[model samples]
Target: MARLELKSVRKSFGSTAVIHGIDLVVEDGSFTVFVGPSGCGKSTLLRMIAGLEEVSSGEVHLDGIRCDHLLPSARGMAMVFQSYALYPHMNIHENLRFGLVCQKTPKAEIEPRIQRAAEILQISHLLDRKPSQLSGGQSQRVAIGRAIVKQPKAFLFDEPLSNLDAELRVKMRGEIVALHQRLKATMVYVTHDQVEAMTMADTIVVLRNGRIEQVGSPAELYARPVNQFVAGFLGSPQMNMLAGLGLQSSEDRFSVSADGGRLRLQLARRAEATTGDLRCTLGIRPEHLALSERGALRVTVTGREFLGSETIVSGTLQSGESIRASLRGAVEVALGESVAFEMDLDHLHVFDQDGAALDEVDNALPVDSRQDEVRQASPHHR
Candidate 1:
């Protein structure tokens, strides 16, 4: 296990910078995931830590030692790429033992290491099979087993399951989780998939154009996002955004009006922030909305999807802005029919015109994270 820290780390290609000055810390034996949209620098940041990319500035420290100047091998790290980078001519046993052989590990110790890794990955029976003969899932396991024989200080994975089918991806997710519990190894994974990050990470780092949007546990981010971007990025169905005007009500309550429909909101802590006719945006998740007789908003259904246990309805709100509702059971509703939906105030989120959350979180987060300074995004970085 190892602790990894990045202090104002940066990277650039000539005059164009891909990764801005960023700082972070990954605790020993923790699984940290880097998630964002394409060209958001998640993969580039991971490659920097793996020593595949040189640092233009700042420092990378591992276990209290400055390691940015060291080679990947000397840094005691193992990387598993998205593609199964296995040697086709080599059988499973050779693939597992290749790293040990490269390090000139004693012949006596190589066999036992290979045996243990093969057993741990449940690939012992496939030792005699070549890469060409194995399935996608099996080939990926061999690649992971190759990394395990090195006994690296940390494991770095770059979208390691993106090529597999949906079913195999789910199965691999469980295997990786079990492997982490059994070994307690430090891990850093890079992916654009939100579902994988939500399901597998102990901590998720949301990035955008080389800057971190937010960092928190899966539950923490889901319940309390600092801004509209973070809220809209993490959820599966995504949060619905609606424009409205807020008026301060007496007794620490507030009211919102959109298209002549009024809804009372209770906000006790931030009464000062809600004074006057404030223009703000209201956000709500699909599951937090339900059909009701006296609902505040009415929608004309445009689409209905039955997702096994849950039914999702997509329609335009009273204001014509689109919104989705995840109601209980399978809902059978005809297209263009009007349906009333009641918003759960407990799950409702309010954002200012600038997309900052109206609710003030009193927790002590990092200084760099609290300040959202960003550079002009280039067209190439999309």
Candidate 2:
């Protein structure tokens, strides 16, 4: 496996600049995922790494060797695309061997590589099957197998699971993670789905408007985002952002008036640089909110979605700001009912009008133990 680095990477179409100057490193044998919404340049950045797209201005390095000038075939990287991209007329075995054949590999050396790939992908039984005769998941396995046979220094995946059904997607995600572990090869994956990035990546790169917003492990980005956009973009149901007026700090406590002073929250003194009045935003995740009799915020129930094990309730604050809460079980709240909600104070986030995260509270909030469990279970975790 090889380490990949991008230094001041940039891209543009004429005068319209896309990827800004971006600097990042993909550690050897690590699974790095590039994630963002559409038009955010995630796909463009991945293509640049694979030599599928030219870099406007930057250096692409593999194991400390500059390779931006290399052709796609000379990069020693195997790419797996979203579309299966299998040759329709070729059987699975022939499809897996096509690349090696084109390279003029010794005939004796090629069959063993193809056989090993098919066996590892568990598609040995389907060696003779054509692309049209296989299921979507099977076809994807063959596509991945094709990459495996190449024995490249790294693998690049461009939303390889996006075309599968929900259940199949989940199944394929596990398979890919397992494949990464078994191979211990560096992989770069591109997807717009945060869930995919969260579950599969050792390191996640959050991009916006062609610039890198944040780069961290799933837990780091989730528990402590560097900005409002990073906070809102990584979570499901999204974080609730309420416009607030930061009040003066009193000793070790700080206060903020949100929802036009109808809601007030006291926080542990954090941002020592800002002691006086400031305009800011209060952020709390849905799962970190709960219904309570002595809650400081009042919300009027709007709707509820019961999803077997948990209930997602949407509401509006006194100032008409929308809010959502994820409760443990079925919640019995009627429409238009006013309810008081409490937040997990330690987990709250504060962002200035500029959207940058303020200095964290002294002593800091403890990382959630559940997050540790996830990392421990991930195959990519060192």
Candidate 3:
């Protein structure tokens, strides 16, 4: 395994700066994921680490050795690309052995390495099959197997499952995670999918506009985002954002009137950031809103999607702001009917006008505890 570090790493293409100064460390044997929207420089950062792209400034270190100046082949890392770059003419075994052969590995040693990799990946029976004869999943496994046979210090995956269908993507996610656990190797993965980053990473590095936004475990980022951008980006169905103006305050709580005074909220004051009447954004996730007749927020149901295990209801608040609620089980609500849903006070996220989180969470909510449990049970857990 290897410990990788980037010290004020930067990248620029002519006059356009793509990667800002980024200082990060990938702990030895940890699964680290770099995730963000497109053009966020995640792939560029990964390529820099792999020596496929040069750093404009700063240094890259591997196991305390400066490697930014080294060639990719000399960096002791294996990379699996989004497109499985297997040779069409080569069989599975030949593809797996290609790298070792190029390095002038002994003839006796190459066959043993190939055999071990194929067996571990459960592709021993398909070793004689050409790349064109295999399914997408099978081809991906061969690509990974090629990397595994190298036995490098660390592995790098650049959206390795992007080409698969939805169901296959889900299945391949589990397989790769299992592979990480079995090998216990250091890995750096780049993806635009937050779900993949949340599920697979021991540490998730969130980037925005070529700059680092937040770096933490999935649970930490989910339960306590540092800013509105991070909060809105990580969750599925996204958090519902409401423009509100603070009206009153107390020693440990405050009241905010949202939706042109149609919706009122009395939230616990976790920080001393907001004092007077200030305009801010109130964020509530879909799952945190429950259907209640006596709820404070009134909404008109616009649409409903019954997802078997849960129901996702889309509605418009009295202020004309669109909101969604994820209610448990099947909920039969008529369209255009006015419904009220209560927000889970403990799970609320408040952001300042500048999109910065204003709360320093003290009281732990049930959902937060559940996220903690998930983090603890994760195979990537430290």
Candidate 4:
């Protein structure tokens, strides 16, 4: 196993600096994912780590040894790219053994390695076929199998599933997890998909503009995101952000007001909120809103989507803000109908104008209990 660390890592092309000084560590045998949107420098950073791109400054260290200046082949790492990139002319068996041939590995050892990789990827029967005959998913598997044959200390995958269809991607996700368990090798995966990051990573690095936003387990980032960007970026359907809302402090808890002190909802005390009026923004996830006759706000249903086990309702709130409510199982609601929705006080998240959370333990029940309640409702990576 290898522990990868980048200290003050910076990359620049000409005078344009793409990667800001970055400091990160990937522990031995852990799966770490770098995730963000396009132009976020995720792929550039990955290439830098792979030694495919020259670093302008700082150092890349693996297992306590500096290797920023080493060639890609000298680094004990294997990479799987978005394209399968197989030698189309070669059969699967020959393609799988090509790397070993280039390295001048013994003929006896090459066949065993090929056999092992094909068996592990369950592509033994297809070994005699060419890449042209394989499906997209199967071709990608062959590509991954090539990396597996290398048996490197660490594996780097750059959007390896982007080419596959949704169902194939899901199947490959499970396969990658199983492979990780079987080998327990260190892995650094890059993707623009939060769902992939949430599902695959032991540690997630959320990056933007070549800088690291937050690094944490899926549960930590999901439960207590450091800022608004992270809170919005990590969730599906996104978090409902009440941008023009005002805050009113009660004796114990706080209430959110719209249109100058109109009670929209009561909120749990923030662990960092004060007694005075604060310029406040509120965030409530779609899954946190419950449909109720006694709901605090009524929304005009604009659309409804029934997704097997759950239903999502999109509507316009009384404040003229868009809101979506996700309820477990099916929901009985119609378009153009008025529906009432409520959020548990404990589930309300208060953000300041700068997009930071507030509520300094305005002490009602022990804040830990409510925090635990938040934890209970939170979806954690298994």
Candidate 5:
């Protein structure tokens, strides 16, 4: 395992700069993920690290050694791409050993390495099959096995699961997590999928337009996003942002009064500095809204979607803003029926006019109590 660092790394094609000055420190044996929307330059940065692309400026270091000038094979890293890139004519065993053979490793050493990787990936039985005869998942395992044979200092994956079906993607995700645990090697994974980043990464680096947005653990990014973009991108169903009037006070609480409706919210203490009748936005996750007999704002249900264990309820607030809430299970609330829902104030997220999060707040309830409520409310599961 080795530590990786990029200092003010940059890349540009002609006069058009894709990656701006970027500085990042990837700890030893850490599984770091670079995630963002398409055209965010995440893959460009990854390729720069792998020496597939030249750095416009700054340095790339591996294990404290400057390696920006080294060749891709000389950088002590193995990369698995989205395409699998398996040799169609070769059997799995030969494909896995091909890299080692090119490096002129001993015949005795190659077999042991191939066997061990096959055992780890549970593809020993598929050794005689060609890429043409294997399923997508099996082909992916062969590609990973090829990387394993190199025994490089770190592994790089570029959207390695994007080609698989949904079920296979989920299964392969678990396998990758388990593979990391077993190897404890430094791995850098790049993907546009927030779900993949959240599930697999020890630390997630969110990027936008060639610049790093935020880097944190999955839970940290989910619970305390730095900006509206990160907040909206990281969560399923996204976050609900309702435009409201801003109020400044030391009490750490604010209320939104719009269209003859008012909703009071407890904001983080850092928001106290913001003043004036500024146009602010209130951000709340779907899970934070709940049915309540006596609530502040009123909305009429517009749609309900049942998804087995959970239901997504869509409604329009009096101000004509659409809101979605993830209820535990199927709900009987009729469309166009007026319903009142309460917000968990402590769980509320506040953003400035620029969409930056104000501060972090601890608003999680005990897990056991939450599970109890879900069990009691969702009759289909029981």
Candidate 6:
């Protein structure tokens, strides 16, 4: 295992910069995921580290050695690409041994390496089969086995499961995680899928336009995003954003008012930011809202989607903003019927004028207080 580091790394295409100066450290034996939308420079960054792309103006180091100028093979890394990149005419055993053979490794050493990798990946029985003869998952295992035979310092995966069906993707994800635990190998994976990043990464590096947005554990990024972009980008079904103006402010609390409702929020501990009459965005995850007998906001249901264990209701708020709420139980509300909904104050998120998150939003209020405030202030309750 080896620690990987990028210091002030950058890339450009002529006058247009693709990757801004960025720094990151992937700890020894840790699974680090670089995730972002396309054109965000994630794959480009990965290629640079693999020595497939030249560094425009930065340093890449592996185990304390400057390796940016080294060849891909000399850098001691193995890469598994999205396409599998298999030799169609070669059997699984030959494919797995090809790299070692090309390096003129002794013939006596090649067979054992291939057999060991095949067993580890559970593809030993299919060693005689060609790439065209294997299933998608089986082919992926062969590709991974090929990397394993190299026994490099680190594994670099570029969307290695993007071609599989949803079920196979889930199965492969677990298998990969298991493989990591068994080998304890350092890994750097690149993907555009947030789900893949969330599920597999020990540390996630969220990227935007070739720049780092945030780096944290899955829970940290999901529960406390540093900006609106991170919050909106990381969640499924996305976060619901509402516009309102701050009405009251105090050291520990604040209130905001919209067209037909108001919200009271507790500030995060040590939160000393200014508050008063400022236009801010209110962010709430779909699962953080619920139907209530009394709430400051009322919405008319427009649609509903049943997602097995939960139901998602789409509606227009009194202010005409569309929002989605996830309910644990079945929802049978008719279209156009008004339903009262309450926000869980402890689960609320606030964003500044420029969409940056304020550091002092509190989420420690008692659940009873939150429900009480909604019940007491709502017109429907009175």
What TM-score, computed on C-alpha atoms, does each candidate reach?
0.90, 0.93, 0.93, 0.90, 0.91, 0.92
Worst 10 residues of 4 by lDDT: 373-382
Better of 2 and 6 by lDDT: 2
lDDT of 2 by residue, 151-202 (tens): 9999999999999999999999999999999999999999999999999999
Model 4 lDDT at residue 351 = 73
Cα deviation at 340, candidate 3, in Å, is: 0.6
Q: Judge candidate 2 against the unseen true structure and give its global Cα lDDT, from 0 to 1.
A: 0.87
Better model by lDDT, 2 or 5?
2
Of candidate 6, the 10-residue stretch with the lowest lDDT total is 373-382
Candidate 6: the clashing residue pairs are: 267-362, 268-361, 268-362
State the local distance difference test value for candidate 1: 0.83
Residue-level lDDT of model 5, residues 1-382, one tens digit each, is: 4999999999999999999999999999999999999999999999999999999999999988999999998899999999999998899998998899898889889999999999999999999998999999999999999999888899999999999999999999999999999999999999999999999999999999999999999999998899989999998888998886654444554434332334544344555435445566778898888876555446788998888878888989878898988888767777887776667767677677888877665442222322222212211222
Q: lDDT tens digits, residues 167-203, model 4? A: 9999999999889989899999999999999999999
Report the Cα lDDT for candidate 5: 0.84
Candidate 1: RMSD over Cα atoms?
9.4
TM-score of model number 2: 0.93
Residue 42 lDDT, candidate 6, scale 0-100: 98
How large is the C-alpha RMSD of every model relative to the true structure?
9.4, 7.6, 7.5, 5.8, 5.2, 3.6
Q: What residue pairs clash in candidate 2, if any at all?
A: none
Of 1 and 6, the candidate ranking higher by TM-score: 6
User: How close to the true structure is residue 63 of candidate 1, measured as C-alpha lDDT?
Assistant: 85
Candidate 5: misplaced stretches above 4 Å?
A: 248-261, 266-269, 361-382
Better of 1 and 2 by TM-score: 2
TM-score of 4: 0.90
Task: Tell me the TM-score of model 3.
Answer: 0.93
Instruction: Please tell me which model should have the higher TM-score, number 4 or number 6.
Output: 6
* Candidate 3 weakest ten by summed lDDT: 373-382
- Give the runs in model 1 whose Cα sits over 4 Å from its true position: 248-253, 259-266, 269-273, 360-382
